[model samples]
Each structure stands twice: as structure tokens, then as C-alpha cells.
Target: MQLNQALEIFMHGEIGIPSAENRSSRQQLAGLDILHSDDVWNQQRQIADEAIVQSHAPAEVLALLADYQPSVDHRITLVDRPTSEHAAYHAAGYRHSASEVLLARSLNNLPAPDPRYAVAQATTIADMEWLNTHDPAKRAWLTVTRLLEPRLRHSFIRLDAEVVARVRVCQVDPAHSYVTNLYTAPNYRRRGIAQALMIAVLQQAAALGECWSVLIASEAGLPLYQKLGYQPLATLTVFEPAEASE
Candidate 1:
């Protein structure tokens, strides 16, 4: 598959449901509501041009996007494939504001799970809420509805029945899945909980016939993901108007 196509699937696959009704309402006002159509995903409000560009968009579409203006300071995020079109977006004055490495691996062979921790799908909203509360910065924008979506799975690891680490997987399509929000509580770091949680989630995905797993890894998490056999496919870049980045 094309790099952009794979990136789109991974991007949409990371959207999780908000943890509370109030948080959902707040996200809507901030124009963070995700709108999906065909192979493209965008925001409900056009305040920002947050879109997944098609791999073969015509020149007219590209031109229109280059000229489109929002009422407020806006950012345009794109998955930077090593193609001429990606270069064109950069030539159009979209500065590289930030980046995340897209990584993927086949689910054919996963690491052995750690026996010291037990992992399971979150059984209730309270379970999800507790996980969210422990890592507010990472899950600040997630919604309860998205978390409960049938295609999405939220899993957590517990030590003596106290939840300590969590990971989320979104089955974007039949064969592709995206993983995110793999966070371990501060007190629980260095305990192999993250690896255990990832193994549990991947095993569940493989059982369901989802052979490929993907995720965008933060810099600090790069080493762990690399050790797990996830190789970098492309660098996803976010471009913002110059002032917005200032």
C-alpha cells in the first residue's frame, strides 16, 4: 500500500472516545471533532486544515488546498511520504512544525507476556476513566463514545488489581490496526508493564485476524518500539502558519 494510505489509516485509527460528557462537549467547541469521509479524515470546523491528503489527488485539489484560508490561525497536518506531492506541500509555504515516526510490524510473532502483570480489556467506563485520570496530558482530548466504539479496544495492565498501564488499539480496516496511548503510571515505570501491555494487545489483534499493527512513537518511546520489531515507515509532519508556531 502507498505510504499516505497507510498513514491515514494509522491516523484515524488513533482517535479515542472522550472520557467524560463534559470533555466531549469541550472538544467540540475547540474544533477537535474528527470527520471521516471516504479515505479522508478532517475536523468538523475548518478553523484548521487538518486533512489526510489522498495519494493521487489532482493538481486542482492541491492548488485549492494551497490557497484555502481559515478565519483564524490554522495548521495543516500531513503525512510526509517520500513523494513529489509531499514536496509540493512544503513548497507552498507549509513549514515543518513537528513530526512523529510511523512504525509498524506484523503480528505473526509477538514477545512473551510478563507474568508479573495481568492485562485485560477495560470492562467499564470507570476503568477507562481511571486510566485517563492517571495520564491526563496524553488522554486529555479522548471521548467516552470513541473508547466504547466496537472497532476500538482499550486494554490495561494491573498489579494486584490496581491498574498501572494502558494501551489502545483501533482497527482501522480488516487487516490494519493502529495502537496508541501506551502509558505507564509514574510509580509503575521500569517494571516491564508497557511491554507486557503491548504484547497482550497485539495477541488480541492477531486473534481477530488483524495481522499488521501500526503506531506513531514518541521520541522517548522509540527504543522500546524498535526493540519490539516496529520499523519506521515514514515521518508524519504537522505544518502551521508561521505565526501560529511562534
Candidate 2:
């Protein structure tokens, strides 16, 4: 597969959600994020399949490309690789910036003022009961992805993963580390959904004992995150070998 396509699948492959409602929640949260390429990011809002899961989050974020400096972060846990000769899970890591957490947390803390929206307890699986009544067809195109872990091949996301929207944690701490996929979908533009998701994600991380979750925020997202409480650790540079692509 091409690199972009591979990244798309990899992003989808991460996360451990097991319900369709949760799948749609991820996509709805990706409001106006700029990473979806022309083919993916066009009016339709799909991301390139191999665009590099630059940022990592719970399998719900939508904007998939690495548009910002620290735009993408993925969490890896050390475990067995059933398909490879490598040892069981070997790494457990999460990525995303402090700012992303701060901004999103802030939003969730406040009550929503907008009327064209609805909010509910976020989870791995979206509530299907609500969908049957409010959005029955919405589930048809959506999926219930397993947590977006990189190596898991037989999860709900693999069966019908389409977008990456949010990365939420059940437990979080300021010192603990985690990955975030700071994505925003087109249909849900400029509504502070990203910020809301981040704040909630960070709070969970902090509660889980994460002293500082890591992430690469976009230029736009940087100040917001900084305001929320994140400082840059260092710049990560990329150098692809000339023959590496071949």
C-alpha cells in the first residue's frame, strides 16, 4: 500500500471502540481540521488512506494528516505481535500536546450555548439506542472501532473504519503520556469541538497520572494548547532517504 493509504488504515486500526455510535462520534468531532487531502479533504471530507497517522488519538478523530509541527501523536503498548516474529507488546506510549488537552477540557467544562448540537457522555461505543431514534441511518456509514492501537488487525475499526475524530482516555494524569490526533471535520467547523475533546482527553490523562501528555499542535492549535498548559519539548525533524520511497 502507498504510505498515505497505509497511514489511513493504521489510524483506523488504532482505538478499541466496539460500537457504531462511537464510530460516528469520532467523525462528528473532527470539525474543520485541515489535514484531509484534496481527494480526502474535499467537500466530502475524507482523508488520504496513507497520509500518515501523523497524530494519534482514540479511533475517533477525523483530520488524519500531520499538518502542524507536532500535529500527530500515537500511543503504542508493548505486547505480542501475532503476525510478526517480534515479542509481545513492547511499547506503551501516547502523543499530543498539553495545549490540545487544555483547550478541549475548557470547552467541556462549560455548558454548550449552541442549539444545533447535542452532547453526551463520550465512550468507545456510541449509544445505538439514541441513534435508532435520532439518527438511525447515521450508523450505516459509521463504525465501532477498537482502540486505535497500531498492530491490532481484527478490531471493529478494521472492518469498516472511515475517519479519525477524538482520542479519549478513561484515566489520565499530567505526568502520564498519551498520543492525540488533533483532527477537525469539515461539516462541524469552528464550533470548538476539537477543544472540547482535548480538554476532556487531558483531564482523563491527568487523572490517570499523566504529568504531561505529548502532542504536536498546529500553529493555530499551538497557542490554544499553550493557553491550556503545554510547552514544546523539542522539534521533530523528518528526513526520508531518497531510496526509501523506492
Candidate 3:
């Protein structure tokens, strides 16, 4: 539950994805862990092109932006609670874009998957494409994820052969599993599809001897995950470029 250890699991799961353009990479510079991805950086879709700072020194913030700016599109993810970094970040031309709760649950006590809904494992580009049909731009990035093979698992529930919900789990090691991309189709919400998919993945992780499962959750998802036994571990505050002044 140490913040750095949690962030390490997050960075390993979200970053380091190989890209066709060779734009995906990671490094430690200016006391920061820098991550870059070819996923076409956007504030809403924070797939990569980021620098993560574990410390709270303003000087480290200044040094990070000055020495390791990956792109104008990049953002800084501070693995700390809301603090004075707001001023330092603003002075550097970034604004607080969002805050997410980092949550974790022990795999030792996972809930059993609700057998009423059948869940399927997706292991190919075709399966990803099916799950991502609503967002075609992500296909290329998903292709890279498929290459990570053996470490990543995608599971989903289908209704009349149509994918209704899905989740991705990254087994970072025998003791750690990182969860991401948990989604349920709009009409399928509140019907237990998301919970079923999550339980299935968690059960799989537990079977693999992963001691923990972790994820960064949006405000909307915090309650549901908390219901499933995940406890908040930290707050990740993201700072991105302020809108250009007219």
C-alpha cells in the first residue's frame, strides 16, 4: 500500500506499451518517472506522454518540466494528495485537469463471479476490436497491448452475442495485478455486468497468486469499486496545459 509501490504497479500496467512509431518509452529523469506513448495524448484519454513525480518538492516539478518535456501534449501525474504543487504547476503553464482515486483490493478475498452472466476471455486483436468498436482510434494502441501478451488479459460479458461489458487486467507479477479499462455499455449499466466482469478477472488474478489488484478510479466508479472491497490508497492529481488565453 506504499504510494510508490502502487504507482509502480500503475505505471507498469499503463505505460511501456510498444508502439509502431517507436514513440512508447519510459525513463527516470530529474527525479521523475517519465512515460511517453504514441496513443495520441488527450486530456480525456490519458493513455500516456506523462511524467510521474513521487516527491512533493516544487524544485522537482520545475526540473521535470525543464529537463524532460516529452511533448506539449504531456501531463504531470503527481502521486500525492491535493497540495501546494497547484501553484508550481500553474506557473509552469499547466492547470489541474483532474484527480483520480487510486484503489486496491487484496486478491485473497475476491468475490466469486456471478455465474448467471457468462464471461469470455479475449486474447486477440479481433477480440479487442470488438470491445473497442465504439472507439476506433484506439485499435492501433490496443494492437500494441495485444503484443504485451501473457501479461495482459481482457475479459468481457456478452448479451445475445453482443459485448456488453469488459475489463483488462495486467498481472505485473505473481503478487500484483493492475486493473484498467473496466466499462459497461450504457444500456447495460446497473445490471451487474461490470461487477461480474470484475469478479471474474479478480478470481483469475487470485488463482495466479497475485496478492493485490489495483486501479485508478474516476469519481463515478469509486462507489462501485468500494462496494467490491477496494480501498482507496492515494489520490493521483493530474496537471495539463491550461487553455490558451484568447
Candidate 4:
């Protein structure tokens, strides 16, 4: 079986589609593709919501997400830029920019602050105002914040003086971590703000007694994560009804 095919099965199974598990079991036997780390919070959210709607208890839903949260949830979006092109990672402009995104690492090793830049963790979830800005790229901040409050078991933030450049960091288990739903305000890329924050997230994890962290780095972000000590674990894709078009 091909990696893509295996990935499809894993994703569908993870979403609670019955047949997906049986098929995925076979794909795993073939060692065709590795299970993904960061499956993103949205997929799990949808599955849990469906279950809750079907009559499961809220506590049960919370248990499952906390226990089996995807090992990785990572994304990169334009938060700000000199030009739309300058703000985005892809050649396509800031089409992917959004309010906030999730980032994961198995470790947290925030570098020492240099004179030019600094990195610190957000004091609290309520204090993320700098991240939820009026910039077009950060327009989704409120939405993202609402999405995370109930869903995430844990989280972290990276800040620069008054700016919040990275708004996510988390782990599903003591040893497994995932990243996703990541975004950067337009004015803050290629400046090492994100890199520093990501390091802080990982270092914090280590200090708290974690040994490994994980995340799904976007295509443009693969190299940066590599520099930060992340390696490819798997590539996953999800298929679902098109809510907007439907």
C-alpha cells in the first residue's frame, strides 16, 4: 500500500469511521506509512461533536480528546507582510493567513535572549490580545481562541515584548506532542520571533518533564523545523464534506 492510501485510512479511522480502522490495521501491517502526530484539533473536534450530538457525555468527549489528541498540529499562515507576497510562505500570497495556529515540539529549548530580539511565554490565555489583532491575517484570532478553549488539554504561547507571534504549543501524552493551527501576524516572519517562541515551547516541555515533542511542519516550514530538530514522521490528509459549498 502507498503512503497516501495508508494516510487516508489512518485519518478516516481516527475520525471514527468504522471501516477505516479495519483497513488501517492492514496498512499498518504493511508498514506502508507511519501514523501521523498532529492530526489537528479540528478533525478531532468534529468527531467529538458528532459523538456528543449522538448522546455521549461531555466528560467522555473530553477524556477522549485529552487521551488521544493528535500527536501533532502545525500550520503557518501570514500574519503580516510588507506585501502579501512578503507575508506568506507560499508564492500564492497570504491566502493561508489566519488568527492562530497550533505548533508542537517534543522539547523546549528557548535560546538565550539576544540584544536584537526576545522570547517569552504568554502569561495567560486571557492575555493573548496581542495575538488576536485587527490585522487581516489575524482576523481569525477570536475564532481560533474559541475553538481552542474547550478542546485543548494544554497550550503555550511565544511573545516578543508586546507582540504575540506564536499562539500554540501542546502535547497529547507525557511523551507524545503535536502542533497545528499555527499562524503569524503579517509583520512577523523571517525575523526569528516564531523560531524563538517555538524553542521556548519545547524547552518548557522539557522542564516540565517531557522528553520528546512532535509537529507537522508545513512544506515551507519543513526546513526551519529541521533546523530546530524536527524530522518528518508522516504526511496526512483529511476528506470530509465541504461545509461551505454544501
User: What is the lDDT of every predicted structure here?
Assistant: 0.63, 0.32, 0.74, 0.40
Q: Please, what are the lDDT tens digits per residue for candidate 4 over residues 202-225?
A: 666677666665555556777677
Please identify model 3 stretches exceeding 4 Å from their true place: 16-23, 39-48, 124-129, 132-141, 144-148, 244-246
Q: After superposition, how far is residue 228 of candidate 1 from its true place, in Å?
A: 1.0
In candidate 2, what are the lDDT values of residues 8-121, reduced to their tens digit?
222332322324323211231233222222121111323222112233332322222223222122222111112221121111122222121111222223333323322233
The deviation in Å at residue 50 for candidate 2 is 15
lDDT of 3: 0.74
Report the lDDT tens digits of candidate 1 across residue range 22-57.
121111212222222221112122122354433434
Candidate 4, residue 23: CA error in Å?
26
- For each predicted model, how many residue pairs clash, with residues at least 3 apart or on different chains? 8, 85, 0, 30
Candidate 4, overall lDDT? 0.40
In TM-score terms, candidate 3 sits at: 0.84
List where candidate 2 sits over 4 angstroms from the true fold.
1-145, 148-165, 168-175, 241-246
- Taking all chains together, each candidate's TM-score versus the true structure is 0.68, 0.35, 0.84, 0.46
RMSD to the true structure for each prediction, in A, is 6.9, 16.3, 3.6, 14.1
